[model samples]
Target: MRWHKRLLAAGAVAVVALTSAACGGGKVRGAEDSPQPGTSLSAADATFTYVPNLDVVTDWDPASSYSNEIIAMENVYESLTRYNPQTKKAEPRLATSWTSTPDGKSWTFTLRSGVKFHTGKPLDAAAAKAAIERTIEVNQGAAYIWGAVDKIEAKDATTLVFTLKYPTALDLVASAGYASYIYDTTATTDDLNKWFNAGHDAGSGPYTIDSWQKGQETELTLKKFDDYWGGWSGQHYSKIAFRVTPELTTAWQLLQRGEVSFVQRLNSQLFAQASTTPSVQTSQTPSFQNLLALFNTQSGPLKDVRLRQAVQKAIDYDGLIAAIKGSGVAASGLVPGGLLGNTPGMTPKQDLPGAEALLKEAGYGPGGKQLDLTMTYAQGDSDQDLFVTLLTSALDKLNVKLTAKPLQWTTQWDQGKSKDESKRQDIFIMYWYPDYADAYSWFVNVFHSAEPISFNLSYLKDDAIDKEIDSLPELTAIDQPGAEKAYADLQNKIINEQAAVSALFVQNYQRAYAKSVEGYVDNPAYPNVVFVYDLKPGA
Candidate 1:
């Protein structure tokens, strides 16, 4: 049973969309209201400033830390492999080279010859194996990412081997980002836990942690790894500083005042404002992130498929796009557009009559049963607010009572993944950026019934869906088109079965200091993970 055939036997499916940066034919907005001229930083005094959305989440463990705040820590702590933006492939970082068995059940990696952690401890295979095992043992949340590993073995001083219980096509890619980051083995689980609780991080990336003023700022200095395999020639930067500015307006002001060289996750309106600033140039990438409405099928009247389908049909995607007034495109399926397994121009079903009919069939028709629904979004995210407001209005037409709730960004995220099950929110909007370009990332792991972190917020568990997801590795390896067809079939089942509804594929926008920021080209591998080292002052 190859992966694709498994997907077919289990049931899986596909849709597409344009991958252009600019939406339609118009100048999208920028991060600030007006342009500020670019400031000059002498080569000798190289420093870069950035504003992350928040202080690093108190939880610093990679398995538990999913917030953008962790990016600061990630920069200081390098992963075994880094995703190459140009090739969209995982390249050696901590590990020099790797090989896998033909059956895909085993993999071995050769550690870099002479790498050392910030504390002057040499990084070796034993340390690497310990790090991998520790992450799996400690972080229950990261299980989905590392669960396939049957064992981690230190073959020698420089060789580490991974034995998988089941074939996993996404094994390598999944390990590239936060999942595969190496940590110090000398530290006990208790010590690691303490660091996470205190928001302290330790790693072996280009930068070394200096000081962290909780909720205010974090400062780091370049360690100048003399033996860095990536090579440190012609590098201008000696230090990087990041500040926590939760308020978008304040961050925008800082950018205008030249306080920070980079800002992230700006809304459409702010982006429009920033577009006019001459000092800043806006860039966009296909982020791995996808904004979605997670329907809790376990509780509430939404347990009925008809009701779920009704809610899906009620959304006015076009109006939602208008409300945001930026680079948003209407999402037509569970898998985002412009990626593999997506067929372009597949419009979502917007038939009110159909929605009403489904609701009526579910005994929730007009004046039949009133629906009181709760939708949660990040507290300060304007774009998410716009989406909620638009979706609320659309649902109201069918006599459904919907309540919009804003949760502290971190709070909502924690609750969404609550293992207690009973404490989980009924409905929430979230995003999924691909760990890699593979369709399996979105379809199999996310929505697969067996995956504990399965994005199937619908809590939909069908033996068939599970089978299809489990079969992806086999299908993909046997034949590309055959694998696609298997996924397509599963997708059709999802739509017909009303598993989950697609909102829109969230567009990624980046604002950096023009070509002055060299090596900043967009990565094709995984749009979400950006390589800071690749960036330098352009010639």
Candidate 2:
């Protein structure tokens, strides 16, 4: 989850006019018109159009924003560092290089020279400091990532230093997708927040917001920044448009007709069809996104750990995976594949008899009183709908009455965090992804103890679990082997020993793009995003 803003409404209007003639069976370059790979093309001939499955922008603010708008924000904002999943390291973005004290309490960063924000303000240590301070002050989004930060000092125009309260991995925290954007602090008006939401930007990114229509045509449009530090000498798109197409069928049809350059997601049936099409190129990669079936441990029949374990074992995981149409696999643990703390072959196979035995022991089977339970998931998710269908049939075997309700994200979350324990659903199902590529996101946010209740819908508070989670960041930064061992112990405790929640399948990031689009690569670190700067027109 993340967010964004727009600029130059007139320019956006002009781009919309151009998009009308360029997209939706417009002047799309055919095989004959496409240039060979690496061949340079002018801006007029290199426009990129993307169709997201839904309205991608939820919050307009960069700081304190945690939503789908990261797809747009990633292109419009820049961070101090960018995490490279392939290398499992932090790479330079705004800051060219950095160094930390041996104890990891003090660090210094060297800013890249000659960069300017879209508002014509020079990027320096002072600017970066002010921007970070603003985010910390607002404390809306993922501000918790900076909990270890004690003080930040602008040592000079080109140098910045950070002192920490403890030995922490500041590098990874600085690369977070949310609350880590470096923007211009200087605003022309006193009401900066109002100015931002009114469609303005101040980041030094490759693209600038050209226009935005909240629920109208071409939801968002971005144009190339002429003064981008990366420089537009290579094959780069001049314009990028994001259209909200809720139906997968409409998006797939548009992709086939070369009306749009890329489609964000497609159903399994459509994905299999796209694989064989000559006009579309499909990519499938492992991702950090995983489905979580959170148990309401604070109240109800599920309060018993045995019942929770019985419920987990009662589900047909294999059938659930097949329902997603090969888009994912049974998750091994809370953390997904390609990230730290994931253990292969750790997931237990479904045992129907075992589940029945546990249910009977808990007085909820044919030999005992029947059990009735309720669950909730986000509406319009086909995969989740399939999960509920299969789960209903499986739970019937245990003489349980399971009621599944689908609601909008806001409604679902509101009910999950309901103050009255009796009013909450027995189970709350949702997808969980990281603000950054760290296992800590899963450990600290979802499982840790929450008083007012944030994302920890499970509502289980174990002191041992809390201690392990709180120690993970520093332990991970200092000792890889120790961290791995600690994660393994915790997984076994939470899933096998305690049965706090059900770990479902991890998503396979899939996308279908027109053949004319080239230089496409899937990075799970930046989920649901395509860097327009790296893409070019191709034969």
Among all candidates shown, the one with the greatest lDDT: 2
- lDDT agreement with native, every candidate: 0.60, 0.79
How well is each residue in 230-281 modelled by candidate 1, as lDDT tens digits? 5688764655556556677777777766656667557676778788887666
Per residue, candidate 2 scores C-alpha lDDT tens digits across 1-539 of: 21111101000111112121121112333334432323322335676888886665555567765666678888988999999988988899999999998888898999999998988889999999999888888877787888888899999998999998887778888899888989887854566665566567788889888766555536777788889999989677888878777788988887777678888889999999999999899999888888888888889999998899898998788888978987878789888877778777677578889989999888887678889999988677888888899889998878988999987666677688889988898988877788788888888888899878877888979999999988888787777788888888888888887787787788887799988888888878777889888888776
lDDT of 1 at 3: 20
Candidate 2: RMSD to truth: 6.7
Q: Which residue runs of candidate 1 sit more than 4 Å off their true CA positions? A: 1-44, 62-64, 187-190, 195-202, 217-227, 337-340, 343-346, 363-371, 409-426, 435-456, 473-482, 512-515, 522-530, 537-539
- Report the C-alpha displacement of residue 425, candidate 2, in angstroms: 0.7
State which candidate has the highest TM-score. 2
Clashing pairs in 2: 1-67, 2-67, 6-199, 64-141
CA lDDT for candidate 2: 0.79
